[model samples]
Target chain A: MATPVLTVKGLTKNFGKLCAVNQINLQVNQGEVFGMLGPNGSGKTTTLGMLMGVVNPTAGEFSWFGQPPTHHIRKKIGAVLEHPIFYPYLSGQKNLELNATIKQTDFNNIAKVLDIVELTARRNDAYKTYSLGMKQRLAIASALLNDPTVLILDEPTNGLDPMGIAEIRTIIKRIAADGKTIILASHLLDEVQKVCTHFAILRKGNLVHSGPVDDVGKGEEIVEVIAFHDDLPAHLNQFQGTKEVKKDGQFYLVKMNNGFHSAELNRFLFEKGIVVSHLATQKKSLEKQFLEILAENNTH
Target chain B: MLHLLKIDLKKLTSYRTFWVVCGLYFITLGFTTASGMEFLKWLANKSVEFGATININRIPLYHFPDIWQNVIFVSGFFKLILAFMVVISVTNEFTYRTIRQNIIDGMSRTEFLLSKMLTNVLLSLLSCAMLLIIILITGFIYSPEIIWSEIFTDAGFMFAYFLEMFSFLSYTLMLGLLIQRSGLTIVVLCLSHMLEAIIKANIDDVTPGLIPFFPMESITNLVEMPFARYAFQEIQDYVSLTSVAIALGWLVIFNYISYLKLKKSDL
Candidate 1:
């Protein structure tokens, strides 16, 4: 297996009497669009903070590319913690210049970063004059000044409007398409589900569930079928690769095992003389799996 | 280190408030010093109206050797305004949360501290340069036939004045780190000055020797009452080494405390 981009082992953080982040273990792979899913007050930001050296970890340790996290490694990783921070009095271009200086990035990257963030026209404008969305874009531009291999953003769209959120999402997807490793921490499940290739659900400083999003409900396929005949449930159970059939009012939810698809089920039903009037395939989304993860945590 | 200083200075210079305050301070120093002879001319004539021979030409205040001490003393007060500038400079990093951001961008804790110290040193140097300009221009206007060697007479006071300004600014930088808010930091700075004075006064009355050892008293003694030397009062013939040592010591302490605060706290 390839070496993980990040290896977090038994990480923990505490603020006096409050244990803000408990023992958490995680491994992020290179070029993975990893989403740290959590609700408000969860340990998502704290975990990211510990990884970035902002907040001191109370226990355990984490490394980048199999090496301990250090200033050198940090230069290769770009991050935005909490809010988009910049000197308000400085122009957008000057702000990136400062970031470039700190990161020891070449002065040439300034123009390229501004171009990527699409703030070239407003490069000379003071940061205070930019809207929230513009400020966020400039922040992304600053992060890109180092041309980092890994990008970490906490709540990138926390306060954006719908259009602004979409704009940011588009930019993120574009960046992800370039195959850069991304670690996004957000409370918005919809945003995470839409953009993330993998996710880890965090609750009360604990990782309840984590894995590839594709494996959330396994490879099982579910089909909503409404048949002219009344005994569709029995027919579905009798079909090959049908794990179980759940009844939901007039429709039946048929759970298919691996190596099966909705077409195969439809073909089986047709051969069994059960003329299905309506059949619709359903794909399990991260939202459904995330809710289940949270529900599981709450019940415990 | 140079690159870091360059970056920090760029950030500071880009801010409008920085240039405004610094410009106002520089101009205020130049204007006041340039108008010094005018003020003396008025005072001399006023004294003459009372039939007193308080001759401006006879007095050695504006002449060589003494002008250095006199200008340094007057320009030393500029540190108070400059302290507010320093307070704003440091507090801005906290207010905008850029100090932590700068670290996140890749600067080490030591780099950040060094940058601020460098800026303070630069401010003191710039103030000294301004003081030099005012003194040179006025010195030539008042006494053009002086020896070139005498131009820097009592120059030790200028150096002492630089230490005094550096020490005070560091004191305010310490407060900036401690409070991290402009208004509150200034409030605490002013209150501490008043409080130190009050405490020193009571302590001075109760015990004479201890008063000179007070924090503010030690700093204030560095230049040794410039006005009295102009009046030919029995003052110390030169800048006191004890006060210089004490001021430099405070300078170190102030920066040490600031470093500790910056290091210990989560940026």
Candidate 2:
């Protein structure tokens, strides 16, 4: 059994009359890349803020490692919220030294983290003089200094170019490979699909969908089959496993019912003596599934 | 607490504005105290040359017992410069959002506030040390003789000056926490100072004894105007325990309110 790293129950946050985060419960386990997927104003940052102990929750509570949340507990969890926050007038090295001071970690770790972020060459430059991508990298280096068991990053690649985003994702993947639990919040579906082992989606402060990334579009199967015989499309409609079939030119798009597999379909067609010219199966894209989830739970 | 102080010093030592403001305060306080007598003698000479027949040199401004009060009272004006430094430092935490970062990095809100308070204590102690050195130098150079017993007789005024500096910095710290914008905080500080003076003046007209209870007035009363003795007029020659207690009470009140503000706010 996997050990639970973080458990949040009935977590809610309301700014005056506007509820920023509704009653939401979530649990993340050890060595899992948990992605918090949401659009703008969906309270992703607010939830992370509360977990970091910077924002007060309106209702409910959370714990780290099955213990109550406290500042001391936070030392075991590293986090970056919204944007990179550091003294602009101080050098990247100096800022990390200050963060190290606050965390009571060894100053020797600063050099190692900076080297991991590939910022060792420019560590002495003032923070304000660095580019946005460099600033984000420095934040990651600071987060890594504590050697935290769980690293939380909100929008780790929010405003970066394509190359910058790739660089951050590579670093995240490298860290996650070390058996550390990571909680990453981002609106990019592609990012979550690529890096996260599990994900939860939020819409307008409400949790709409959550589960393992592998479980997405798992129940049903869709197959595209083409045959030289024109009657193949007609035969597909009568198959017990077939839910719906649409013809496009010479190919028949078969939507299989729940629990149906492409092998069963091929077997059924072979028994019918229908030779197919082409056969392919496609799992639903996460982008389509995500949009469908949001569309299904569009109560707000 | 020492660790918190170290963290704050690291944040401050690399910032140019912090050094600039501290340097400005050091020079202002050092120059004003060191050259005060010469400036007065120059003015006395100009008046003599102008046929005004004034003999300002006869006044013993740097006398051993009186020098403590004289030096401390003059240093009060420069304390506001230090107050501005406190304001800028505290407000920069907000402007840069480092306060939020600090809290996220395993620091409690109380720890964060305590770190800033520690900085205040450090600044106050430094100011006092500079004052002690300058006052001793000035007293030994100009006094007729160094009476070891009398040299520190008026040193209670130095304690009062410390209370004055510390409590005043606490007041500015509260202001910085309340108003996160440095420029706006300074503006509010100045406006409130004027407003407090006006209120104190009006309150003195009806209840003269109650004026010392106000926050700013209480701090100011800790170091009462000692220059009145220069004109041979009556003055409170030493620190009063009642005034010290009042200032101490206000200091506690200011720090408590600041703590509440930091605790309740969503940094």
On lDDT, the candidate that comes out on top is: 2
In model 1, which runs have C-alpha deviations exceeding 4 angstroms? A219-222, A229-250, A254-274, B46-53, B205-208, B230-232
Estimated TM-score for each candidate = 0.92, 0.95
| Model 1: per-residue Cα lDDT at residue B120 | 90
Instruction: Tell me how far the alpha carbon of residue A126 in candidate 2 is from the true structure, in angstroms, after superposition.
Output: 0.8
DockQ, prediction 1? 0.64
Winning model by DockQ:
2
After TM-score superposition, the amount by which residue B36's alpha carbon in candidate 1 deviates from its true location, in angstroms, is 2.7
lDDT of 2 by residue, A162-215 (tens): 999999999999999999999999989899899999999998889888899998
What is the per-residue lDDT of model 1 for residues A1-300, given as tens digits with 9 covering 90 to 100? Answer: 989999999999888988888889999998899999988898998898778776778899999999987776888888998889999889998888888878888989988878887889999999999999998888888887888889998999978999989988998998899889999999887888888888898899998888887786566778899988877778889988899889888789988888888898889999999888899988787788788779987999
Interface RMSD of 2: 0.7
Chain A TM-scores of each predicted structure, in the order given, are: 0.89, 0.92
